[model samples]
Target: MESEAGEREPVIIAFCCHYCAFTAADLAGTMRQQYPTNIRIVRLPCTGKVYVNMLLEAFVDGADGVMVAGCEEGSCHFLEGNYRAKKRVNYAKQKIEEVGINPEKLEMYHIGASEGPLFARKAREFTERIRKLMQEENEPENQIQNEK
Candidate 1:
């Protein structure tokens, strides 16, 4: 788990459900929760709103890892938003593999709006995985070309 030395901080992009994960993230902040500083959250009305294109765009934009945060099963704000996100993540995983990116760099998680500790734990866990992946010599290059 080696971080980029000297100056550059690791970059992570999280697409969070506005109803749950996003609010939990906000709560984490208000609670002064200590977690990795690498994560940058992008709020979406629902995980269903997070297109595969957006996930790829994050990788192309230099995110070391990307996570899609949504509500627990059957608890989505839009009824089936998390389900849609789960399906999309699977599709994106396959596409990313085809493009030479390690699919493990992507993750889909469920959180409750009041689960600030859970949110922080997920962030730490995801960040650790990214760190280890970055340190691997045989790491696959999954750099998707940025769209103009």
Candidate 2:
């Protein structure tokens, strides 16, 4: 997972809503909760703005993982934006899987505006998941190299 800095740092691009997830992430920073530095957040007016192509592009452009973080269920500022984002995330996951990438590399999270600790925890958890995924993807090759 750590293949010389910037080679494979397990990066996750998080698309977060301004009212919910983005605010929660800001609170996480304010609270000084330590999470992985690999997360790159892109604040959006709503998670509904997240398109499947944007997600796929992230992977194509080198992101190891992608996350669409939005308001909790029944609490979206835009009424149904979070739900839309969730569906898009799932669809994007399927698309990536079809392209031979693990669907687990993409995730959707529901976080409230005040859930700072949860934001940090999710960030850490996603980073770990990507690390394990990368490790698993490399294991067979590593084994073959050792046998050689």
Candidate 3:
């Protein structure tokens, strides 16, 4: 939808693990790093707590894109939470594609608690990517409507 600035704004949902991703986000804020305001973060004890259904529900609830951010590989506080989160994210990607949404709209990221800059960069990048995807998805329909 268009925001007050008259620019199309996609709703991006970020599922972040408290041990790493969430902390990184907080650090980013403290560092005055800027990311897209369209991103809505949902904090989780661990990325492993993320489920495919939750990802799908985000879309159904009008999220244009979803991101699951977890600890770096082999560094999950729960030992294997990141690994399980990765698997679920991959599965969710496939399912989202089956429903005709761009699979790229959903992604998983491995982040260290110290990577605040990386977190901000990724949030901006992902937001732009989803914005482009949404534009592309609507282009054909807009053209058809114009043609009629």
Candidate 4:
């Protein structure tokens, strides 16, 4: 997982809703489902409460990837929280892309409280994707240095 420049393990920030996403993560642990340990979960009362700045700050502070996990469509405890979160996540993705990072580094997911396996699977997948992206980001530097 270390890059050529001694890059450490990828750090992933996950904003999870209390009602669904958080519960799902808890269930994942209870079920002994395996996922990446690099993810740092931030519990939110509702996904709608997540601001774009919060997500951006995660990247600025060295998170290689970000994830917003909420209740399934039409099932948000706050009625429209998940929908609003989806829109905000999309907006953040675009902004990050403008700054030269791949938009794929940021993602949104909807998970029910009972979907522990799915949650774990997605977490693992996201971590692997970010690891690949980090490696890609370093490849050009390595090539240029090699040419010297």
Candidate 5:
């Protein structure tokens, strides 16, 4: 990942459920919680609405990582929606791994609607994780090993 000036950074995409994670993200902004701006959020009616293809497409479109954020287990407005999303995210992870992509690039998170600071923290943590992963990949030793 890189900035316009080629400075290191990470671009992450977060798919959030309207009933939970999305509201938390909105509240995070109002709460002035400091987080990296590199996380791009896509609000969905339910996390279950996300398809495996969509996750893969985000990667293809240059996202360094992707997150699926939704209601916690047993707390979804739509029964089992979060569970369904978790399953899909896991499946997507396996697909990416099969293609030689790092499975760490995707994650599923459970967030409460009122957890504003938590949302912000997650955004920052994911961005950092991606940044470190990218740094490791770009290291001279890693390049030489990969080229061998």
Candidate 6:
């Protein structure tokens, strides 16, 4: 579902590796597949290049959820870039949660060329999760914080 103007749409930013996940996303688009429209895919040369601050910036800029998609384990075009990304994501997840957002808001997935369908499915599933999170847990705390 598309986010409306007044209602905060679950904004999801997907950081995808150029070699695998990004290409698969493009293929999903080419195949005329319909996935959640809320996800915005950003292509990175490797997941390793994504910094912790970059993920935080997405939330600061209105992203309700963030996802990093890279090549399957031991299948990176850049050898171990995805491994580095996994570590960074874990750190960022903790940091984000400490700052009052749910750590589940951030996720990581690895897929090969043949997993475009899975990529699409993941996007859908993440979007749903974000939607539910937003509905159930987003308001009370923010409302209290805003009153202060």
Best by lDDT: 3
TM-score, cand. 2: 0.91
Looking at model 4, residue 134 earns an lDDT score of: 76
Q: Give the distance in Å from residue 124's predicted Cα in candidate 2 to where it truly belongs.
A: 0.3
Assess candidate 6 and give its TM-score to the true structure.
Answer: 0.89
lDDT of 5 by residue, 1-148 (tens): 5678696778899999999999999999999998898889999999989899999999999888999999988999899999999999999999999976789989999999999999999998888888888888889998897677
lDDT of each: 0.88, 0.93, 0.94, 0.93, 0.92, 0.90
- Per-residue C-alpha lDDT of model 1 across residues 28-116, encoded as one tens digit per residue: 98998878989999999999998899999999989989999999899998999899999999999898989777899999999999999
Which portions of model 1 miss their true places by more than 4 Å?
1-4, 138-148
Can you write out model 2's per-residue Cα lDDT over 1-148, one digit (the tens) per residue?
Answer: 4666554788889999999999999999999999888999999999989999999999999999998899999999999999999999999999999987899999999999999999999999998999988888779786586466
lDDT of 5: 0.92
| Clash tally for model 6 | 0
TM-score of 1: 0.87
lDDT of 4 by residue, 1-148 (tens): 5555787799899999999999999999999999988999999999999999999999999899999999999999999999999999999999999987899999999999999999999999999999988777779886575466
- Candidate 6 residue spans exceeding 4 A from truth: 1-7, 138-148
Report the number of clashing residue pairs per model. Answer: 1, 0, 0, 0, 0, 0
Q: Give the TM-score of candidate 5.
A: 0.93
Local lDDT at 18 for model 1: 94
Q: Say which prediction, candidate 4 or candidate 5, comes out ahead on TM-score.
A: 5
Which has the greatest TM-score?
Answer: 5
RMSD of each: 4.9, 3.4, 2.6, 3.3, 1.8, 2.5
TM-score of each: 0.87, 0.91, 0.92, 0.90, 0.93, 0.89
lDDT of 3 by residue, 1-148 (tens): 6878686799999999999999999999999999999989999999999999999999999999999999999999999999999999999999999977789999999989999999999999999999888777669786585466
**C-alpha lDDT of residue 8 in model 1:** 44
Give per-residue lDDT, candidate 4, residue 64.
91
lDDT tens digits, residues 1-148, model 6? 4456565778799999999999888888888778988999999999989899999999999999999999999999999999999999999999998988899999999977667788898999999999988877648987677467
